[model samples]
Target chain A: MSTQIEQQETETEADEETEPEVESPGERRRAQRDERQAIEEAQRETEEASLDDENTITLKVFRYDPEVEGKQEPRFDDFRVPFHKGMTVLDALIYARDHYDSSLTFRHSCRQAVCGSDALFVNGKQRLGCKTQMSELDDPVRIEPLPHQEVVKDLVVDMEHFYDQMEAVEPYFDADETPDDKLEEQRQTRENREKVKMSTRCIWCGACMSSCNIAAGDNEYLGPAAINKAYRFAMDEREGENRKQERLRIIEQEHGVWRCQTQFSCTEVCPKDIPLTEHIQELKREAVKNNLKFW
Target chain B: MAQHYSSFDRGGRRWLFQRLTAVFLIGVLAFHFMLLHFVNHAADLTFLGTQARMSQVSYFATMWLFLVTATFHGVNGVYNALVNQGLTGSRKNAVKYLLGIAGLLLVVQGTRVSLAMTTLV
Candidate 1:
């Protein structure tokens, strides 16, 4: 495969140790690996030495790789990154990867908070890595993948479960009826739009779900983000009353809004400042009111 | 999804009842504590003194309601906590019935004790 060739190329170029023509291919490969190990040891020493320097910031990053023999066990790798005025946590991670170790892996895009690809556990809090500044954190910023999710590799977690929960809520808006004319428009009042405004801003970053205690324990719980997603559609007046009732039914299931303890953990960690707990409470009230009407 | 049509299966009723009972208990619990501990000194109270208080129709009803609400709130809270801790399958059903029976017995025995204290029964 082409990937095999690329792997070989990187392996050979990893270290600049002079190779003698007399050695076998196996021997050359071993020598190259040894040189790479020696480089890692030297880098770690420099990483330790820079801790005393005033200009550099220490980053304790969680590292793991199931496929790599030595890295199979989870551990924290320290990187010494030069501090800058407006440098964010993502910038520091990028600098560490580019300058010190190319294998330091993390997901990042857009360099802004909109992409929602860089949610990380920074300093014992869930935060957007690109939005969190290094100056605001303590000396050694501890960065790890979000908790309550299986880590796929270094700084990347399995988001499949989060996606599954989101899907279970039937997040798409479904109107009960549409106008006969194709050109006709479905309009929403300013009040209705304003009501669901904050709930619509969710970026599916998984930070709220990761921060939720109920979602962590009850695996079947729909979670804050998914419930908020339901809130957005369920509150929209454009979706007819029939659809709203249907949406309410979905969220009112045994593991739905009832599982929420109103801890506000999701609201506190939301990057978009969505009032998650308040929305969940409102849904609970709505479900009860609907039931009372039937009774 | 067809099963979700009924309001009872949605869990909203119990959730609402829990909050309602919590509000009621908050007020009643303070009164119970104050009456027993502050207003009527526990050391000075005897069996006849308690019977005299329980013999009053209004007092008997209040105490009975207090006992029933406390038992429901305490047992329901415990069940919710265990459910939230990922209890499921047959174990969840076992806990549900166990708590239900325990709550029922508590209410029954509490009524009998309250009736024994009252001269009206």
Candidate 2:
């Protein structure tokens, strides 16, 4: 694609040389720039015209702004984007922003699933926009901010609450004691790492929390990502037994893992393919066993 | 966040009991249905036949235990559902006590009715 654009730029430069020179040097340069812009405009128009319904995809994006007078009321805007084989929902959104409405707004960073910044409600499901292929979705795709979260603007939802829940679990690993030697490493067994491996894959995309029905209804529920974070540290062998017990108590609280209905919505929407519900269940079982030991 | 120090308030005990009762209910429910609908047949049910079944100490004890567990399971499920719906504060306490009283009344009435069916009572 970069090569194609470069070829077009060179061709436009060659065409500029053929024009008769009458104006001053600076004026000529300005005239040449204007002509090149007009040519680019015409090329774009023709390219768009040729990109019939078959070659273009339609995106209906949610628009909202509490501060903008005309845009205060939420609405959906449609943009026609030229489609390519590997184009994703995020690609279409970028095209719409660049070529159509510069005011179009959304959150995205790496343009990959790793950033976990582009989670959106696409076609009635929680998904990462950068990870969802345009071809996999139906045409006239609908995109909105993740549900159960307060919309900040356009496709951006307030993620402060989600971050709070994640922090509530104290996601960082705290070991009981360090090795006597400064250079000694606190290594984990292969089996122990494997046990907590899936739980450690949370990208904090907030998709699982948005997809959970119970989380939607219960404002106090810790939700799946937080429980998975707790699971990650609680199951780690290096963490002290006291730390593990504290983590278990946190998850076993009234609004913690017990609130999960095992609906599998979190697991289904997770971009990392983390078995979230299973981890929550494991935590519940661990909590129960700890209590039984006392009994 | 509410700090839970005791096992009673941690929510784990009720969660475990709910699962335990659910497992017990599944088996006992199947047996109850099979006994009533398949073996005895609804058309063949009579007061005397019910009395004869209730007269056996083993069967009577099982039925009573089933009633108690079923009440706890059903009531606890409803309570949990309410809590998950963001029920809180005094309203949540009200619902908790109301549901508890209702469950107790149900078990007591159930036991009395079962005793009325048995000659030993």
Candidate 3:
């Protein structure tokens, strides 16, 4: 990939020399310097691209097999993909598989942000590959698997634990009692609906959970995503008094609301703008108030 | 998930009592030291001195308040520190509940001891 990038640069340089120079001394010198700087930056970018750059999008995928490896040291693999207008990191990965190496693996579905698949460490932050455009990033976008998760393969993280924590909260709502058929539509205040509407928007993407430092050491923690799940129902007026108290009890467990340290990372990374910290704080207040009533 | 399980949960009350007692003891201990050591030294102690202080109901009340606050504060602070260190699971919960019951008993006994020391006895 480096040789190809070098070859492309030399060819461009040779083409520049062939063209007749024009303009005044000052203008020509500045233009030449700018052109040289641009070429150097492009070359430097390609070199830094894959951890190995070629002339294309260099992807440095980290590989580790916890079971098969002797010492389990991570290594990067390189691939140069043809650049396209508005090409996404996911698009580049797909192109790498079709052309260079078929074994280069990653996850994607729906090819849209809604599926919550294709979340990779694009540079140093968690981002959905389908949503991040290649043109918006420097050459050879450094694609690695998400951190704090067991990688099943190249880019696919084992989401079983994430799923289990989510399920433990029983994400499905259990209403107090069915509304009478005589009164088909249940009435709710507009203010109450809006208050919990943000919490209800959580997609269970586990993006917030992965960023939380608290969840890193404690496996018992229900995590921000699950706590937000509890908040959704707990704050909902439609759930009624019986179900509301039940939701509160779930969140009031030892590994629940008290576990949150108001870190706000959960709120920052929530794709749906769920206001996770605010909801967790409210749950903590609810827990405190519930205790005080006994006095 | 159960209804109002937090009522019996002792986490918040311990947190509050520890902080409150720490604040109270700062003032009460300073006042008690000045009165006991410098203002009315043990060399000048007498039944007249004891009667003079205890007869004033406010002074007797303050003495009991200091003891009750210090006992609850010191014991509950130890409990909160243990809990914040990842105390969970059934066995830990059993120990926690036992500690809570023991703490309540201590508070009851300590209050009685403080009342007995005061003129209220």
lDDT per residue as tens, model 2, A73-122: 99999999999999999999998997889889999999989889999999
Residue range A1-295, candidate 3, lDDT tens digits:
6666776776678457745766676876677677766676576565445442334577777666565554257677787666768888889888777656676667788777778777788787677788788888876578888777888777778888888888777788667876779468766689988887888777666778787877765666678988888887787777788787777777777667777767787787676678889888888788778778878
Better of 2 and 3 by TM-score: 2
Report the Cα lDDT for residue B7, model 2: 46
Off by over 4 Å in 1: A1-52, B1-8
Q: Per-residue CA lDDT of candidate 2, range B1-121, in tens?
A: 3222234359999999999999999999999999999999999999999999999999999999999999999999999999999998899999999999999999999999999999977
Off by over 4 Å in 3: A1-56, A65-73, A83-85, A134-140, A182-187, B1-10, B14-121
C-alpha lDDT score of every prediction, in listed order? 0.88, 0.91, 0.73
Q: Among all windows of ten consecutive residues in candidate 1 chain A, which has the lowest summed lDDT?
A: A13-22
In terms of lDDT, which candidate is strongest?
2
TM-score of chain A of 1: 0.82
Better of 2 and 3 by lDDT: 2
- Please give the ranking of all candidate structures by TM-score, highest first, separated by commas: 2, 1, 3
I-RMSD for candidate 3:
5.1
lDDT of model 2 at position A277: 93
Q: What is the Å distance of residue A159 in model 2 from its true position?
A: 0.4
Model 1 Cα lDDT, one tens digit per residue, A1-295: 6535755665667644445456788887787778666666665566556655687899999999998999999999999888879999999999899778899989999888898899999999999999899999998999999999999899999999898888877888778988898679888899999999999889889999999888888887889999999999999988999999989988998888999999999999999999999999999999989889999
**What TM-score, computed on C-alpha atoms, does each candidate reach?**
0.86, 0.91, 0.61
